[model samples]
Target: MLLDALVNTTDAVASTRSRLAKVEALAGLLAQLEPDEIAPAVGFLLGKPRQGRVGVGWRGLSAAMGAPAAESSLTIADLDALLDRLAEASGAGSAGDRSRELGEFTALATEREQDFITRALLGDMRTGALEGVLTDAVARAADRPGDVVRRAAMLSGDLGETARLALTGTAEELDAVGLVVGRPVLPMLAATAASTSAALETTGEASVEYKLDGARIQVHRAGDEIRVFTRSLADITHRVPEVVEVVRNLPVRDVILDGETLSLDEDGAPRPFQETMSRFGADAARETVLHPWFFDILHVDGRDLLDEPLSTRLAELERVAGAHRIPGEVTADPEVAERVSRDAIEAGQEGVVVKAIGSPYAAGRRGSSWIKVKPVHTFDLVVLASEWGYGRRKGWLSNLHLGALDPTGEFGEPGGYVMVGKTFKGLTDELLRWQTEYFPQIEVRSSAGTVWVAPTTVVEIAIDGVQRSSRYPGGIALRFARVKRYRDDKPASEADTIQTLRALLRE
Candidate 1:
């Protein structure tokens, strides 16, 4: 298929706020794609290239812009091949080679195609076709069940591969995409509640587990081999050998454990989040030893527990994890839940997560089955832009412009971020220096004092609450907002949404 066809479909998807319309447009395009082209096309539509980062940034992209072709002649295969070559470019002269290759590729694409490619490369595709919408479209195009396609996508942790399988492979093959011991599946996510009582109300007879302020790790063990993955499904096995050893000592021969790992001080108190992340990101061994705490077990001894209830999984986890199991209590009493929350906080944990005892693990989906409660109102928002600091903090990026996701375009462009507020508080000098050095690399444009970025950085912001305001496009402003930390472990697509913040007004 021609690249123009996919670009036109994305444009159509972005032009409408109706999700059905976007799905229909995407489905129509998906049906026309050849079996081999489905995966790359899906990746491009999702604003992520299958080749991953190709070392091409905004500056490199700008240098590559040239006169566009009058007509559309580039095929999807041609674009994928170009990206493959660009991804393979490395070594000393890789930058110049990438620029030259990008220039040649852009010269052959039409204006619309160029814009689409640019947005895709920058992870800024604003089409309303999010993964859920696109999954529906894929199912519609392939004449398969939506649940089947969704399960396949979630278990495989690859929507592109799921699309290829659903479109070209048999239904049995698609359904057969089960949990593998080493490959990481998408981690289950949680919704939020105001308090432990509120969370328990949503999940009756719940397991109120401590919500640790640490890095999420998914450990997979088969025989003696172990691997660790982050919340975003990035492999960090080599960086965390201690975690591997802990999982390696598990009683089961094969198991999949979901949990958190963090560095602790001599007093057994959790270290600062940045300290844990620094240790987690480093490949070399450090003095800080990270302790693994398992909360849920997905698979053990060839028994897949994902379809099992939380009660069952907890039983399995208790049997195998022993001292490594996260602290929690299974109770229906609201008072008991509140006590657990207090205990967790006093223990230097975040708060508590109330999970329904009978609820199955819903990977990649955030539902009310598991609800987290914390004292402070915190949200993972995207960094839309940043302004230059002044006075004593001069020459650094200090003020951060925050945005919330609008997946349905209720407040703005579909699958785009809507600016809600800005904050300069809570940033240390180190953070300011990091921001100054980082933002420009992903910058799309700049004004007199602000540099607009690609809205790809996810930062955790603590707020008193949100109030109705006309100052921002989202009709709400954050009250007393401050940065808690930068969530490098999370993605912008998974950040909290505008609708979520608007719901706070009711609270």
Candidate 2:
């Protein structure tokens, strides 16, 4: 199939608000693809390339200029092969080679194709379609159960391959994509609750485990061989030799364990999250030794425990990891759950995760089987600017750029605000409309898509916590920030200060 066909389908998908319409459009497009073309097409429509990052960034692509093709001639196979070659470029002067290759490819692409290619390269197509939406579309196109397709995609760790099998292969093939000892599957995620009592009220009998403030690691061990993957399934086995050694020493010969890895101080308290992240990505000279705490088991000694309940999985995890298992208690009592959560916080941990004992591992999706309760931090911040919205929010000013007061001139000018982060979450349509009309009234300047506003608007912002940052002037940024409401009565002078956020870095 031609690349033009897939690009047109993606355009149609982005032009609608109804999810069912998007699924129907994508499913119709999938039905028309050849068996071999389905995989690459699926990847492209979902704003990802099967070849992964092609060594091209916005600067590289925007710098290269070429005349567009008068007609569409690039095939899906042709583009995929070009990307494969681009991914292979490396070593001395590989940048020039990649630029040359990208220049040639761009010359053959029309203007519309160039737009699609840019979005695909940046991994932000804004098509309102992602893995979850495409999974449903694939199921509808292949006449298969969505649950079966989702499970296969999660286990195989490749949505493109799963779509290919569902479209061209049999049901047995989909079922065969089970747990493999050395391959990583998507980790189960948790929903949030106000407290342990609220979470226990939802799930009668639960396992309350301490939530670690560290990086997520999925370790797979077979004999002496072990592979460690991140939450996004990127293989980082070589980065942390300490993790490999720990997994290899486990009692079980073959197993897939889900856990968190972090560096602990001499007192056995978890370090700051930045310290853990620093050790996780270091290529050599691993100074800060990371310790892995096993929380759940997916496969143990050739036994597939994905379909089993949380109780059975925890039992297997305990037997396999023993002392390495995460500390937790099984109870239906609200008081016990509250005590456990409080103890976790006192130990320098994040919070507690209350999980349903009878819930199976629902990978890749954020189901309600698990609940996380954590303490929230809220502050009154000033809105520095706002960016124009996209898709459904095209006309309104969305995505607020937040800033905190700097009284001591620690970051730039005295008595000015320093940008901490940006957030578009927790904004309703009413708030969007209000900002659209109100922000420009106090606009300091307006540009292509952003409007710089006066620092008079104080807004209440909630965050998970703060993290060390090099991009922000205060050397810290808000983690998971969202708008609570506009603090209309407050002034920018009374807003929270950078010192307040820096204090969280110590905690």
Candidate 3:
């Protein structure tokens, strides 16, 4: 298939607000793709190339641009092959090699294709074609059940692969996709609630476990060999040997555990989130040892517990995790849930996750079955732009332009960020310096005082809640918004949604 075909379909999808129309357009495009082209095409549409961050950035992309080709000739296979080469370019003189290759490739692309390729490479494709919509499109193109494709995608933690399977393989083959002990599945997500009581109301007879201020980890152990993956599914087993050793001593021979890992101070209190992440992202061993606390067990021995109720999974988690299990109690009483929440806060943890006792694990899905209640309103928001500092803080990028995700174009363009508020609060001199140095590297555009970035940075912001406002497109603004920290572990796509903040009006 030609690259123009995919680019035209993306344009159609982005130009419409109707989700059904977008899915139909994408499905039509998917139906025409060859089996081998499906994954790369899906990845490009989602703004994530299958090659994964080919060391290319906005600067690199801009440096390589040239005049466009008049007519379309580039094939999907050609683009994929180019990406493969770019991804492999590394070492002393790799930068020049990539520049040459990118320049050559861009010279053959038309204006629209050039824009699509650049956005796709930078993961800034605000095309309204989110993963869920594309998953539905894949199902439609392949004439497969939506649930089947979704399940396979969630289990495998790779939508591109799932798209290829749904389009090329049989329905039975897709259905046969199951939890493997070694492969990390997408971690289950949680909805937000105002209080423990509210969360319990959504999840009756729940396990109200402590919500830690730590990184999400999925540990897979197979006969003493353990692999640890972050929330994004990047393998970091070597960096966290302590976690590996801890999982290795588990009672079961093979297991898949979902949990959090954080460094603790001498008094055993959880350290600041940045401290934990600094240690977590290190490539070499660090003195700051991280401790793992398992909350749910998905696999034990040969039993798959994902289909089991939370009650069953927690039981298995407790048996296998033993002392490493996270603290919580199963209860239907609101008072008990509230006590757990209070206890978590007093222990310096975030809050409580009230999970339904009878609900099966819904990987990658944020449903009412599991709700998180934090006493303080904190959200993961994207940094849309940064403003130049003035007065005493001169020369630094001081105020942040924050945005909430609008995946369905409820308030604006689909798969776009809706600005909700701005804040220069809670930033230290160190943070300001980092922002000044980093924001320009990802710059998409700039005005007199503001530098618009690619909306790829996720920051944890604490607010006094939200208030209705006409100043922003989301119909709400964050109250007393301040940065808690930058969530380097999270993707901008996972930022809290405008609907989530808008719902605060009722409270």
Instruction: Candidate 1: give the clashing pairs.
Output: none
Instruction: Evaluate residue 347 in candidate 3 and report its C-alpha lDDT on the 0 to 100 scale.
Output: 100
| lDDT (tens digit, per residue) of candidate 3 on 57-95 | 788889999999999999999999999999999899999
Query: Residue 205 CA error for candidate 3 (Å)?
Result: 0.8
Off by over 4 Å in 3: none
Q: lDDT-based ranking, best first? A: 1, 3, 2
Worst 10 residues of 1 by lDDT: 243-252
Q: Candidate 3 local accuracy as lDDT? A: 0.92
Quality of model 2 by C-alpha lDDT: 0.84
Q: After superposing candidate 1 on the true structure, give the runs of residues whose Cα lies further than 4 Å from its correct spot.
A: none
Error of 1 at 30 (Å): 0.8
Error of 3 at 103 (Å): 0.8
Evaluated at residue 267, the lDDT of candidate 1 is 96
Q: Candidate 2 at residue 138, lDDT?
A: 96
Clashing pairs in 3: none
lDDT accuracy of residue 85 in candidate 3: 99
RMSD to truth, every model: 1.0, 12.4, 1.0
